[model samples]
Structures are given as structure tokens and as C-alpha cells.
Target: MSVGWIRPVSGLAASQIVMDDRIAQAEAPPGLYRLDRNWHCDRIWLQVRNVLGIPAPRVYGWSSSTDNPVRAEYILMERSGGVELGKIWHDMPWEERLEVIRTLVGYEKAFVSANLPMHGSLYYAKDLPSPSPSQFLDSVNSIDKGETFVVGPTTNRAFFDQGRGSVEVNRGPWPSLNEFVHSRAARELACIDKFSSYPGQQGLFSGPNQYHPTRALKVEVLGDYLKVATQILPTDANLSKPTLWHSDLHSDNIFVDPSQPTRILNIIDWQAVNVSPLFLQARHPSLIEFEGPIPEGFEPIILPDGFDDMSEETQHQAKNLRAAQSLYKLYEILILRRCPEIAHALHFRDTLPGQITGLASSIFSDGEPILKGMLIQLQDEWATCVRSSIPCPLSFTPEDRTQQKRLEASWSEGVELMHEILTEVGAYQGWDGWVNHNNYPVYKERLARCRENFLDRYAKTEEERSQWIQAWPFEDKTHSPTSL
Candidate 1:
């Protein structure tokens, strides 16, 4: 596929001329051309127009010549000029920046109203070849170890065999929350059982009175967290409809036009779009976190309230940053329910407990005690959930009781230490200073000691060593101002 056209203006002509001079020179009309795979380009352009309500670019159409048997498709559209919002942020005033954000938000609203689903694939643990019939059958056989038999009618079987046999069976296009939940539940159950029976001679379950050495332990722990998460699941099924979403809404995708202060532009990459809940689209942190600090001079744009208030010119640029922040909190809670370890371990790791502890301290210093306080609350919640789910064993020896008590004490101590750090830092800078300040050497040192202590006690035994090795936590390496 290709987009080719005569340049509408001299500026584009100059650019093409310069390009031609630098590369392979061609004496053709000054025009722009983009070559890409036909189906993919067509799908992307169609999706953008459908979701954004923009007209499809004028296509010169498709052709296949004897010299080139492969079909070639082409689109020609007038080029719109604007600076990428990321590059111009610092130059733009604050007010203009806010308008840009508002415009982006509007685009999202329009996409939602169009009823087009965002498209993205979810990662699953099944070791299947692909989401096709062959892989599904293979997975079924692995689990059941039974003789495989084709059960469909002869004609149906023939059709199935004739189709691409290697295509992986996608769990979606799931159009509803109910479908997503049901499918995920089935997948979760399969994973749980698979991990439970995993074979390893030195595994945690090998010895009498030993614990399960599989990653199943993390999954089980995460499941306990999910019991609380269901409370916040959206009950309004009507609001659960799929919407266009940017699966990777990084900073680079946003573009702003200084001339059109109220409008923002999106590159509209359909490859990362998905049909998921509107909430999922809103909850994406990358949408807001990208671009770092709002451009220096740009005024903050206030997002329009509802879809009705949006204009075609500025709709895609008007996302409500504050609302997005609130949605993120809810998303955090929901994600924790589905995959607590994967979610929390990204921030909180035993090897780098200080990263979390420092976060607590910074929150206190920044006058947002609520942030640090959440950690203590989370710990209490975890303890309560564990106590409720796992009953106390009457047959436990004194040593077992002592170990349990120590575990509880350690958790409590961690909370206390976080509180203490917050308080000390809070007294000097207050909460805001703690948050805004770039350094935290003292907190880092304290965290290092705590991590070392944890490793010494829990990672010493063979079983503990194996578990620790298996639990791959993400590492943090940001330097605190205190370190500098």
C-alpha cells in the first residue's frame, strides 16, 4: 500500500526535493508517498476514519501490473501541519498546553461514542503454539492425555482442516465484560492447576511438612487480594461497552498545534488500539505520565465535561488529566485484584523494599500523607485477608507459632518504619517538600539495610532460596537528591 500525491504547497515540495537530492534523485512531481502493507494500511486508515469520524484519505485506488503481480494500493490526503506536542511543550504557554490536553480528551470521547472497540491482545500463561485450533487441541491433549479425536461432521472437519491450521485462538474479540470475566476465570483456573502439579524434586512440596515451591504461591496470594477487589468492579453493565483505546499512549503519539490552540492531533496508530472497557482506556497511566511535567509556558487545558461539549476540531485533545488520575487509582485497585504480585512487585520488592519505603517518606514530605498511609492500610488489609482465608492450625508446634508471630511482627515493623520516616521528613519539609525534592539517600540506606535483613532471614534456607530466586521482582534505580 502507498500514499502518493502532488505536493499541495511549496514547503512540502522543498522537503521532497531535499530528500531526493540526499537519497536517490528523481525528477518526478513534488509529491509525498508512503509504502506499506495493503491490508494493514487499509485497516489502520479505515479504523481512524470510523472512530474519529474523519473521511478516509482519497485513494488513487489499487493496481497490479504484469511487471509487479502483487497488488498495490494507494491513498492521497492533504497534509495537516502541526508541531508534535512533546517538542513544543516547553515553548508553549501553560494555557495552551491545557487546551491541548482537553483536545486529546475530546478525541477519546469521540472514539468511545463511535462504539469502535480498542484492539489489543492480553498475555496468557498457556504454553499453546497460538490461538488456533491446533494449539487448542494440543493444550487439551496435554492436560487430558487422551486420544485426540475429531468430533465434527465430515464437511465441517474438512473446512476446519483447510483453514489456517496454525492460527492461535484469541480469547477475544471479547465484546462484553461478562465475556472477559468468564474467559479469564477459565484461564486462571487452568493456570492454578498447572502450577499446583508442576514437577521438581527439590520443589517446596517435595518434603513432608514442606510448602509448595511453585510460582503457584504468588498466584494464590494474589487471589486473596482479588477477594477485596470485586467490591469496586463496575456494576453498571451499560458502561462496560468497548471503546477505542491506545494500548501504548506514550508521549510521542501526542501532537499539538500552536495556531489551533484548542485543538490537538493524534497519530491514531490502530495497531495498538483495542476494544475494551472505557475505564480501561481512561486508566492507562501512560496517557498522562508521558511528556513528564506539563510544558513550561503552556497553560493547563481544562477538559470539556461530556461528549456533547466536544468539537470535531478539539475532541481528541481534551482528556481530563485530573479525572485520569482518579481513574488510575481505581485501575490500581482492580489490577491488584487480577495480578497483585505482578502489579505490586513492580513497585515493592523484597530486595528493594527501600524503593517503597522511600516512596512513603516522599509522600509524607510532600504533604500527601495519604500516599504513604496507603501502604500501612494495604499491609493491614493483607493481614486481615490472610487471617480470614487461612485458618489457624491447632496442631502447630511452639516453633511454628513463633514463626507466625514473627511474620506478623515484621509486617507491623515495616509499616512503623515507613511512618517514622515520613514523620521525620515531614517535620522538616512538610509533605510537599518530601515529594518534590529529588534526593533520599537516608531512606535508601535504611531500605538497603531492611532488604539485607530480609534476605538474611528468609533467603537462607534452600526452600527460601529457591522461592526467592524464582520471584523475579523489578528493580528501581532512580537516584534521590540526598544521594547527590
Candidate 2:
């Protein structure tokens, strides 16, 4: 029952960074052995591998507590020989980097071209019960209930279609695409109420924009706009099609032949792989992007002539920037030729300037200032686009422009309010601060200090905790942010 590793597989062994030293083999066999403490999720690796026929590590044998062991789960896979591409990426010549990009593009293009039953995560459907929306939700909630570190595995079809964002949007296995998108819009808007339940989050739930007076009328008005916008957009079939996306496609996840640096050996980490709308899955691969504004307006991404002459770090950044543009350009071409709706969704400079006006009020997102401006621009574009259509409901009047501005202000106000509350509660330092979970200890300490040093003379009962929380935010019931 025991397996031995002949030697350490340079890029294949479970590194200290990825897993513990305890999960090692004495020798590298024809197959790589992987022991995972929590491998409850069904191996979608096999499904994706078979369907896409992409060059990735092939799993030959696998077992988990449910089927074999009482403790760790194991996967024995054919070892693809290679050095870690990440270990030598920056040092590779420019030609080699371009070759890698060209090869990777081919791999990505092939994987994306494969068809699927629907938009969701891929799972092995054999021996599973037919999926339903309710079953999917129950499975998700059950997964959430389990130990955070140990994800439970299930063959439930419903388990695969979880959506992105702060909440689950596409809780599916839905019967139709229309239902999927409609449900998504409705649920996202509903999340506004959920965010407000937090004492610190009341500010966003209360207002339309940062500058506008709170009014119920404004909230109703925003909701109406969102419903209409979601209905009109996503008209193309590609926007509804299911496609695979590997979110963690960073350098560490890739292996390459050292002698022939451009040849990929294996791609690891498929656990978070999701099959969703092409728009959701079509982001530029991590290796090809640097953290910055997305290249938009169908602009060409160019690497400067002196890119290699620059410092090693600068050269890497330049390559990543160029790669980002190249990848996005490739996706743009694919979408334009095959799926214009998905293409339109991705081109923020063209469609986003209009589509966001409809999306802003319906969806709660971070980066309020940036989003508000984008929505304002989209509204103007939307108005212009609809102006020539006779009897168009989307036509913008001067009053409509004023309403749009009001909505932006109201949304910004709510964003600011939530930030302020979180700050007051010591969960965050400021509106623009990085959300650090590490601050939690400090937050608890501050809370203890506040209760010890700052209790009011009038508050002596258990009800006083609410009073204290309210007092910190100066919660004014008479003047809700959404008030007319």
C-alpha cells in the first residue's frame, strides 16, 4: 500500500511552500504521489483532462477517506519531467519568453474551445443524482458548514456551479440561461440588504450616493434601472455558454523542460477550476499580467525595444505588461469572430461605458469612486446609443442625467459610510486601506479597551451593547441614507 519516490522531482515534489515535508516519497516513481490532508472535492481534474485533452499531469490512481484511507487522501499521477518554470522565468531570454507565450496561448485556446453542458464548475457527472438549483444551494451551504481548512468532497452535480463575488450569484444547475442571469441580477441586488445588516455596513444600505440625501425613492429608482439594464444586456449566446477557467495559473503552477524552456511539462492546481460564462473565465493568464489598469479600447500592447536592457525586475514587468495586452487582444479576436456578446462584455472602453450604468445600482462592488465615474460615463453613452431609436425607453433627458448623477452620489455615499463604520469598529484603518485579516487581533483588543474605558453612565443592561455600537456610528433612524 506504500509508494516510494526515487528522488525529489525538482518542480514536482510537494514543496515547503505548497505542502508539508511530511507528505514526501523516498523515490520518484513512474507516477508522482500526492497526499492531501483535505481532498474531499471530487477529482474534476480527470473530467477537464479528458474533455480538453490538454497536456497536464494525468492521474492514474486516487483514494480518499470515503473510499480508501481513514486519514489522508492520495493521488498517484504520471510524472511529467521538468524544472520549475517559475525558478527560471525571469532569467529566460526574450525569445524563449515569447515562445512560452505562443505555446501557452495555443493550450488556452484549445481548452476554451471545448463545449460544456452549462455554465458552472465541471464535475464528473457519473453516478450523481440529476442536479437542481435547491440541491446546489444545500450542497454549497453544507460545504460552508464544514471545517474551513478541510473541504468535504461530494459527487453532487449541484456542488459545481457556484458563482463569484461576495455572495453566490449563479447557484445553479439552472434549466435555462435566461433564468441563470435573471436570478443572478435579482440575488445581487438583494445582497444590498445583507450588507446593511452589519452595524458598519448600514451607511451603504442607507444611501444612493455619497452626496445625495437619503431617500427610499432613490433606492426604488436605482432598483428599477438595474432590472431594465440586466434584461437588455447579455443578448448573445456566448455570454451564456459554460467554459473552463483556472484561476491559479501563476508561474508556480507551471512546469517546463529546462533544456527546451518553451516546452510545458505539467500544469498543477486544478482545485479551484470553474466552468462559467466566457466573460467570467476569459481573464488574461496570471503569468501574462502585472497588477495595473486593464488594457482597454482594443489598444496594442507593445514591449519597448530596450525591455531586455532594463533591470531584471523591470524586464519582468515589461514582459508581463506586454503579455497582458497580447492575451487580451487574442481574447478580443476570439470574441469578435465567434462570440460578439462576450467580446462586447469584455471591452470595457466600448460597452462598459454604457453597460455599467445599468449594473452599478444592482451590484455592490468595491472601488466606489472608480465605479461611480464609469457608470456616469456608461449612462451618457447609453443615452446617446438609444437616442436615434424611436420611442426608446432608454433615451436620456436632462432630468434623467440629473437622476443618474444622484444615483452615483448615493452609491458613493453608501460606500463611504460602510468604510467609516468598519473603521470606527477597528476592522479597517480607512476607506482605502488593505483589508487585512491580521488586524483582527488588534480589533478585538481595541474592542476590549473600548468596553473597559468608554462605557456610558446611562447604559447598565445587556441592551447597552447595541447602544454602544449605535453610538459609535451615530446611527440616525430618522435620516436613513435611502430616505426621500
Candidate 3:
């Protein structure tokens, strides 16, 4: 396949090409693209753009005429010129930052208006055969049982004998919360754990088990939290209407062109795009805090007060951000309530403040104390749930026990080593001025070592281990000079 004179443009993982120097990209074959391994959602992006008539890079042009089969799989897209909104947010004037937020909201609204299929609906087909009708019944029989079906990676059909019978179908477009929870819980948990373990300091201490020092302690805490989560799972009334969403809208995925101000130049990596209710989209604090602290001597484009001053205009945007974050906790609870198997495997329990605080801390890294307090309150609430005789929604298995223990130990040792390295390298001189003045090379080297350790300890096989090592250098190599 020939890419028709397309040339390389800036990108981290996938091959980005500019078509004819004007159109900015040529088409490529499906499943060959590697920005993300999951190619299922990429087709969705092509479809969405086609339906909306948005001027996206061309796709599906692959043929023998293309010079490179690999290059032909992707469309050449014009590289938008701008700094990432994350980098400039803190330094930009407050109004400018608000403008960016407002722009993001508009983009999100546009996405929802497109009425694309929800992720679950796209992936899980009701007409598909299952191994057993009884198995499908099991999924619908109870919340906890349904969750077990949801969280595991295998499609529902894989779990039962399709030859035996057809599974019962729901009447509406949206799956029941029970069904969605069961269907998605496993993948979400796996993705969280896997990505959190990405070979870098940035990935560490960012998930549910960060609080405890030992595996037992972490599991004990998690076990209790699961019980509380189950109790707090939003009922049917809380379920919102389904909409198209960039389910994985985080800092790295969104590109900003400062010149465009109101328009985001590009939203990249649509691997996780899915049709789902707004409620299912998880929040990430890093995305919201794109404009972090500004460096000295650099002229700021967005002012610090913008977030505060533009609060009125951005209140809905802020609410969406908050909702995204809080939904994770809600998911944790719903999964536990729906799937006793997960609870048994992980010894999950419902703790009130502990889970909430832990989630908040993970989201807002800077607000540790407040998050910690919230976690404490969550723990107390779990105790109340226990006393009330609500069926405890947690269970654990030996594998879960072992993994939990290993992760806790890894975290404690990693944090200690990180502190030592930071202290020796002078990276922690107080949050306000420390990151700005720190030696970046030293930080990068230390981070690389941390990544190595994480891969060595947690990765499943040698090949899997090697992949992470290869992926690490790209992180350091791809950033622009102005990024720092």
C-alpha cells in the first residue's frame, strides 16, 4: 500500500503522516495501526467522522499502490501548532485557561450530539451465541454475579456453550447497570492495574492500593472498601442517558493549538472511544490540571486566576471532571455489589471514607491530607454498613491475596527508594519551587530505573517485560523543547 507522498509528523507511538503537505494525512489499513493495540474503536472514529462530515484525516485508502503497507493504514493529518493545554494552563492568564475549558466542553458536547454507539453495545452483541443459557441467566440473576461476567476480558459468549442455547436479551438499548458492571469490571480493573504499573515513577502509587505498607494491609483495606462500594452503587435512577464519549479523554490524548484558543487542533488516539452514558466515563485529575505551575522566566499565556474567575462558565465542565473521578469509586462499589467472586478473590469490603479518600488522593495528587481525611471517614462508614447487616459484597482468592501482597510491598519499597533518590538528587525542595529547578536528567534516569524495577517485578513474561523497557525511552525522547 502506498501512502501517496505522506511524510512523518510529530507523534509518540503511532506513525503520523501529513498528506500533500496540505491535507496532512493518508489512509491506512485497519488493525495494523499501533498507537493502541485495540483497533476495534478506531473504526468507530472513522465512522463518526464520516457520519458528522468532520474534516478528519482520510482513512481506508490502503492498496498495492501505497508505498508502505504500514503507512497506508493511517490517514495523513495536518499537525496542529500549539503547546499542550496541560503545559500552559498554569502560566496562561485565567481567562485563556477558561477559554480552553469552554472549548473542551464544546467539543465534548459535539461528541455527545453525534450519538455514536456506546462502547458496550459496540463490543457485546445480543445476537451472539453463548455456551450456556444458564450462564447468561447467572449474569442477570444478581448484581454480584453479573459483575463477575462483566469484569473478565473474555466476551460473554466465550464463557458458556453457544451450541446449547441463546441467552436472554434485555428490552432496551442500554444494558442494565448490573449488566454493564458485570461486563466491564474485569477489563477496567485489569487496565487500571496494568497501566498503573507502567514503567515510570509517574505510574506508581496512583491506584487503589497505595495506602497500606504490606499486601495484607492493602487487601484488608481494599476488602473493606469493596463492601462499602457495593452499598453505594448508584441504583437504576442514577443511570443517565447513553451518549457518545471519548471514554479515555486524558491529558496525553488531547492536543491544543494555542493560536486556535477556542478550538482543539486535534483529539488523538481514539482506541477507547465508545458509546456509553456520560456516567460511565471516568475522571482524571491530570487532565483537569493541564496548566500546572509555570516555570520562571517563561512568559505565561494563561493566568493562574483563570480557573477561579471563569468558574461560572466552567462550572458544568468542572462538574463533569469531578463526575468522571467520582464514577470510579461508584464503579468499584457497583462491581463489588454485583460480583461476589471479585469480592472473594480480593477480600473486598465496603469502607466509606477510606475508599473515597484514596480515590481523591489518586486523582488530586497535591491534596493528600484532605483525601486522607476523607478515606478515614469512609472507613467509619463501612463499619456502619457492616452493623446494618447489609450483605458484605467482598470475597478473595489466593491469587488475589498474593497479588495484593506483592503490590503493597512493591509500593512501599518503591516510595522509599523514590524518596531517597529525590532527596539525594534534590528533587523535593518543597512543591512550589522544587520541580522547576530540579535536574531533569537525574530525574529521568531515576525514573527509568524505577520503570525497570516495576517491569522486573510485575510483568507476566520476559517478552512482556522487554516491551515495557522499549516503551520507556519514547516517553523521554518524544517531548518538545518547549514542553519543559
Candidate 4:
């Protein structure tokens, strides 16, 4: 399994990094793989972190390993003293929030600037099982003269999750963006072939509206995606360039010294960091990401024309909403000023975001309609998007589009309802049915209420109520039946 390095780390083997959570009936979750991923998380990105010039934990002694008395791994480093920013984010005044924005812009700048060559996780040479060059010794850019580090297979959980951790598949430190993205279809195919049952389009709302996908349909979608993706992706060759991203950047992960609350002390939880193509990595930090509509361009923040005539509660809500919109716009402005390259990437994605999203489409995605829609979009746009002389590999009928649009609309409606419920319950980001221990009771009660409300409003008959109850995602799914 992958091991944590003093900084961040990643590896390329399913046995080395992938894990399964369905434990009651499935094999034990790969504890070693988690250790491996955590070990390398920050270490691999040390150079970029160095670029930001942020103070990081000083490693006195560290190793990429899973061998020890505890049968796990740990990094021995000098700790930075700071409280989690999440604890006081809301309490921070406007000026402090602005400072937070500026500081994070610098991070965003660094994330976009650093150029790595391969699409994989970084690992120490010694940590690999095989010392031979044929197995693990390949990196276009080594961190040191002696080449202590090497780019290995990705530790992205998509490769390892479910029961696929034990299966042999190409978990690569891919040499090219095409190879990296092309692996999506192969990966799904491998999972379908290896596992008896696979998780098909799972989500909180998707549960009550179960999509019983077929093996043949899954294969067909993957085939279409593989063909169309080959013709339409990388949108820009520059987007093909590998860039490292910390995917998760919530306030809790960014620590601040209590004495200087606005100053970032350290960013933690560096596990699962992946060096992906710019198209995949191009996104604002989660802390800066907004909900609902945000203003485009660097427009000034202002209240609605009749805001003063609103009720006190309405005014308060309006003020909060305006502030959120303003902050997100400000973040964009900061990007434009400090990191124009990043700004350009964001603009490119905004205009043709589907190309990037569609690049990730495959059999194992949420639903057939979404998958089919992406493939269809790619096929439709090939002439204008790719400008390829060759004919496109896929097409969809008007009937297919009409039917898929209805399904997509239903999916969106379900997502919106689930999102409202999530906000009400204070569910963890993208939470399906599971919650952390500290919030189990509150979440359980809230979820039960949500389920009841859903039944009252949508469950048309006793059979429907029974179906939804069985499909309610908030319940513990660890003990649920599994196919893959």
C-alpha cells in the first residue's frame, strides 16, 4: 500500500493505494493503502508549497514506509501552532475575509503555475516493492540530483475503490494526458469484468430513484465515451499539461495562528493530491467556490434596487447573499490580477465546460443519460470543438436526446431537493447517506425528518413508500448488500 511521506506522496498500484469501504461482506479496507496515500499527499507537492512560501511542518525524520511496530505509518515533524480556520471563518470580519481571499489567490496561482510531466502520484524510490527500474523507476522530473523520488501510478481512489483494489489494472504515472483520460474507459471495463456487482450511478437522490443499469448498456456507454473522448478532448494542448491540485481545500484544512487569525499557518489533509491535466485541475478552491448564481466578470457588489423596502429578516438574508456573491466575484478578480493564466483557464472552461466534463464521462459515471448526453455533446461539437477532418465516432437520435433531456432534468430536480435537505441537515459536502461520528445523532434525526417529508410529498403509494425507505441513503450502507 502507499505510505505517507514527510511532505505529500502518491503511488500507482491498486494494491499500493486503492481501498474498499464495504467491509461487512467485502474484504477488509486497505489500511496500508490509506497510509501510503496520506504519506505522500503533501510531500509530492512540497515544491509548489515552497513556491507559495508558506511555512510547513519541518520533518526531522520521515520515511515512505508501511513497516513499523504499529503496522501503520507516521511522519515525525515539527508541528505548527494554529487553530483550524473553520472554527472562526464565519466570525472573521470582512477585512479578514478579504485577506483570506488574497492569500488563497497566491495558492491558486502556485497550483496553476507548477508544471509536472506525468499524470501520477509521487513516491520515494526506496518505498516501492521492486527496486528494479522496470517496475517503478520512471519520472520525467525527479526532485533531486540522486533521483530519490519517482512518479508512480496514481492513488486516485477511482482506481482502487470497491473491490478493484486487488485486481491488476494499469494504475499509471501516465506519460500523456490522452493516456491518463483514456484509462477511464479501461478502468471501468476492468471493474465490470473483475467485480460481480458494481456501484451504478450512486448518490443521495439517485437512491430513491434507483437506476437499474444493465451490463450491456454500461459497456455500450463506455465504448462510446472512449471513441468520442479520443476525438474531442484536451480541448487545448496546454490543458493537456500536468498540474498538481489539492482537490480538497476547505477552511478546516487551512490552519491559522490564533494570534493572527487572517494569516494562514498551514494547510493540512494533503492526502489524495493528484497531478492531473489542467482541464481536470482548473477550479477555484472549495473555500472560494460559491453556491447558486455568482456575478460574472469583476462587477461591483450592490444590493437589489428595492432592498431597503424589505423586511428585517429579508434584508439580513439579502446582505448575506450579496456578501457571498461579492466574495466569489472578488476571488475571480483576484485571479485575473494575480494569475492571468489561471483566469484564462477558468474562462476557457466556462465557455466550453462540457468538453472538460465530458472528458471524464465513462461507464462508471452517475447515470446513462449523463454519460450519453456527454458523448452526444462531444459528437455534436466535434466539427466546431475539435475541428477534426475525420468523422466523429458517436451519434444520438433526436428521440434519444429528447428522452435523455427528460432524465437529466429529473436528475437536476432531485439534486436540488437533496441539496436543500443537505443544507438543512448540515450534511458534509456531497454527503450521500453517511455522516461523521460527532454529528451522527443530529444528522440521523434530520435525515429521518427529510425522508418523512419526502414520503409525504412524493411517495404516491404504499409500494413507493416502501421502495424509498429501503433506498433512503442516510441509513448505514456498510451493512448493505454489495455486488462489486
Instruction: Give the whole-model CA lDDT for all candidates, comma-separated.
Output: 0.37, 0.50, 0.39, 0.63
The best candidate in terms of lDDT: 4
TM-score of 3: 0.43
lDDT of 4: 0.63
On residues 1-484, what C-alpha lDDT tens digit does candidate 4 reach at each position?
Answer: 2223222122223322222121112222232222332566545545445444654554443345556443344444445568888899888998998899898888767767655557787666665655345334333355652345556778776676555565676788788777877776687777666554444334444345545445675677777767756555545676666776777788877889878898998776566677677766777778866566777557687888899899999998888888888888888888888877677666666544344454344355446556767667767777777677878767788997897787667766655765766677777654334445556688778878877887788788888888777655554554322545
Best by TM-score: 4
Indicate the worst ten consecutive residues by lDDT in candidate 4: 20-29
Write down the RMSD of candidate 3 (Cα, Å).
14.9
As for lDDT, the candidate ahead, 1 or 4, is 4
Expressed as tens digits, the lDDT of each residue in 150-263 for candidate 2 is 111222222221122334444554445555555555554445444443222334443211332222432444554554454445555665456665666778778999999888
lDDT of 1 by residue, 1-484 (tens): 1222432222122333343233222222234332222223343444456436533332223221213322222232223345555566645665665555454444445555553332222212132223334212111223432322111111111111211112222345454455544333333334334333321111112222223233443343334323333332344443444544444454444544667744654353333344455443443435446322343222343455785677865565444444444334444444455434323332332212222222221110121222223333444454342344543222334664454455344445434544544454342322222321224466545545654554465565777666654531212422212110
Q: Rank the candidates by lDDT, best first.
A: 4, 2, 3, 1
By TM-score: ranked, best first:
4, 2, 3, 1
**Model 4 CA lDDT for position 428:** 60
Separately for all candidates shown, the number of backbone clashes (residues 3 or more apart, or on different chains) is 53, 26, 80, 19
How many clashes in candidate 3? 80
For residue 111, give model 2's deviation from the true position in Å: 3.0
Candidates 3 and 4 compared: the better one by TM-score is: 4
lDDT digits (tens) for residues 1-484 of candidate 3: 4334343323312222222332233344432222222434334455445544332333333222235534333333334345555565545664565555545454454544543322242322232333223223221224443222211122122111211012232312334444443333322222223232222232234323243222233334433444454345433332333444554455555567666644565566555445444444423223553322323322323333456666665865654444433333333344345532332322222234223422421221122332233434444464453444664444555665565556546556546644654454444432211233235566657656766666666667877565545433224332211110
